[model samples]
Target: MKYLSSGTKYDSCNQSAICHAFGPDGRCIQLYKTLLTNYCSGECTYCPNRCERDVTRVSLSPDEITKITWSFYRKNAIEGLFLSSGVIGEPEITSQKQLEVATLLRQQGFKGYIHLRLMPGTPKYILDQIAEVANKFGVNAETTNKSNYSEICPNFDYQNDVLQRLHWTDRIIRKKRKEFRGTNRLVGANDTQFVVGAVNEPDSEIVNTVSEFMKKYSLRRPYFMSFDPVPDTPLSENRPSPLWREQRLYQVSYLLKEYGIKADDFDVVYDEHGFLSNSDPKLELAKANRDMFPVDINSASFSDLIRVPGIGPISADRILRSRPLFEEKELTRMGVVVGRARPFICINGKSQASLSDFLEACS
Candidate 1:
């Protein structure tokens, strides 16, 4: 009776704001994200809706949620739904309600993207049901370490609650992958979110945990939430994680996952506090490996080209496919952002563009 409301601008999704979520096929689609309810049993110290907090809590029925989502889709306002909820009574109950909303959406033939947040400690049967319907699934591992997790979310079991569910998601995704090979269909991928600067954990711990998750769980990606202290929460006095810190993490994560950069390579990029610099990590790595620089754009391997800032895999492949003896202008047309890549590349055995050349172009 206490917690019933329309919408809260807490997550990346909202009706007016089109929060684009990447699908299994790597296409970005807008999502209609909202909480199913704000009621909760797990009294996490940092959350605004802890059992003791006097916030405006609300629960939307599955039908109500479906109607709103379908309406949004009908207007072409959103391409999908990202549904999460507070732990109401039992975790399973919350999970079931969310599943019901997703099921209702599917039954109504609203076959757009649906990213379901798996509640910690939810039963395996319920997990399977949700997996079948969701286009992507996520379970938030708020903190990196189990001890830190206990400090933040005291009631939750780190092993049985969080990681186990991630394991289940991985298994389901693998099974789904086997079932959906070679078809136009793209099977869902599992992602986890981390609350950066929460529990005073270092960037090293955060990235290490991400590495472990990727290696062990076949995780698709890690989402970073810069911790913002809410008034009345236990961590109200704590400082918010800088947005730049989160951005740097994404850069490092990309380097690790996409660029094939190893964890040990981070030693060159991370500062004394194990925090990454605000500068682009790719540029930092490139500058560090000076001997590898001034790479021959015409002949360098795809791997080498991507190491340079602004040169992505697609553009690198384009370079490979394009006619030999590439000119400076041709690189731009191939999607290689020459400005960023210029300092690191050589065109026909000469530096593609010098600092003065860039200055002249800018002037």
Candidate 2:
């Protein structure tokens, strides 16, 4: 059993990939990701798999895929299979074929974990059928800005098809959960890779879009792939996003989930130049809005708890709950990093004099 953390980086041939690895009973579960075919018809500027390129593309037959999965499963090499493919031919045809493989796996009694990627432009009925067979389904908006859709994914229409498919998939997942009643297992929903540096869109926009998806569909996970310049892609010459910027986006995303920070609240101003790249977005926000901080930890609401640097919503709640038991001195003594926390939080109505003052005291 292997467990992949949210921030764990996995080394791959062409790029470093990030994924969550779930483990059970002190053992890490094996997660296998493979593409059915690297051949694609869509012309996404940032994708290595886009059509019109002379890359070595391979497509395993359904039987071949099944055999590979069974061989690994029999040895407990993997707990599940994550199958995705570059869109080939019509979306309907490609999607149906992907579904056929998943259905066949289930028919063969291989039901460990099957997660299928739903390509944009897939029919609603086909999506439903895929949902019926798959344990999880995922789709990638790729870019958040609508204008980039044309420059990035030229063949895929953002308005009519892609958005519709996502909404329909959400509806189907909801419907299935309802039909299965309380006993039915929830089907996980995921979004695809965000090409971080391929376009000029700010991190704020990308995170906002993801936040909305999480709120709307209770999406299980949102995978962020920092844009790497793939050889021969239209935007191959484009620089990759600054690593810190990508890291901050992931941090802010965690804040959004753990601290309940709304995307709008942290929406950064670009200055007609570019997104902020100096400090972590949450730290920047906390520094800029000094008035919001030094919140009385003893009485601050859960929402207020998240406004403090280093303190997320959960920690805030823990503070509020533990206030009755621990005094301010005790909390500081309990290794809460009082120096960093002092500027943003108050202890029993007593605010820190200043960041410098708190630092001095802590030092």
Candidate 3:
């Protein structure tokens, strides 16, 4: 099946099809994903759409987009549009043009979900307007660490351009939600692809940066696009980030959200080169710092409870609630996976093994 507009097809037999609703009956509702224009002026080191690349570029006119959307809507082929564009000029001009497209859609009474990707360096007013018109507002911070950002996206400055734009849009969305008396429903935040192995940054740094952003900004869900090396980019010869590293980054991110572990609390060690790949970062932390675990599920603090290998936030909560009645062995039998936990957790006043002994065994 065709998943992208680039004439790329997938194996239809291997995939399942799904559907959703639009505003009213007779209206179609598929995600209308397309580029506003393929012509980008930004000289991002990793982007194939950079102005320096010699490729077929297309810019859909406002009228063209409107007509296409309407036809798709009438056929129940799409529910809303996800319109993104390359930086055709400076951010200000590009943002204005993007808003114009959304404005036209609104003026035409197209009320389906509109997801727009804001151009970096767009003025606050323009971003606010885009947020007002679109159902979701997305910005690509690709990498949150400033050093990696500077190296990969050389044309764009993180603090001056990207962060400022995100802050502005975030402020506007929150304010507008308040003014309109909308529920805790948030206007979202979107980040784009990170070039993993192109730079020597660790997964810990990436998770830390994202966690900080979520905490400080009340950001909506963050999307991670795995680094895929395109053949002609400046870093094409650089190896792609290992798949496990990307997966581990996401796993650690989930743990941060679910169990409240700070990135700093977990000490992830790299080999002589970089990035520890032998086991999950959290598991590695518990294994190395035996003093921290085989925590007494019956008596450990919420923070302490989380350090156990197999226990997550929910399991810790259960332990806290059930401890007054259940014995350590009973709790272990109830699917706590105490084999992992036994290495780091304690029962009543005693650990299954001494902290030093456990560390020595794991070592």
Per-model TM-score, in order, reads 0.88, 0.83, 0.75
Query: Residue 5 lDDT in model 2?
Result: 19
Q: lDDT tens digits, residues 76-157, model 1?
A: 8777788888888888888888899888888888778888776788888988888778777767888887899999998898
Candidate 1, residue 355: the lDDT equals: 76
In candidate 2, stretches whose alpha carbon ends up further than 4 angstroms from where it belongs are 1-30, 215-220, 268-274, 325-337, 348-350, 355-363
Query: Worst lDDT window (10 residues) for model 2?
Result: 6-15
Candidate 2, residues 1-363: lDDT per residue as tens digits?
111111122211111222234545232346566777777898888776779877776677788778878888787777667777778799888888889889999999886778777688889889889888887775677777568877788888886566777788788878877777777454665445566767888776777777887777565456666777878878888888776676677777777777777777775433345475657677778876776877776677778776776665556656766775335566655445566676677676577576577799899
Q: What are the lDDT figures for the candidates, one per model?
A: 0.80, 0.69, 0.66
TM-score of 3: 0.75
Best-performing candidate as measured by TM-score: 1
Q: Candidate 3, overall lDDT?
A: 0.66
Least accurate 10 contiguous residues by lDDT in model 1:
1-10
Candidate that scores best on lDDT: 1
| Tens-place lDDT digits, model 3, residues 201-256 | 76666766777776766554555544656667787787666667766776766677
Q: For model 2, what is the error of residue 227's alpha carbon versus the real structure, in angstroms, after optimal superposition?
A: 1.3
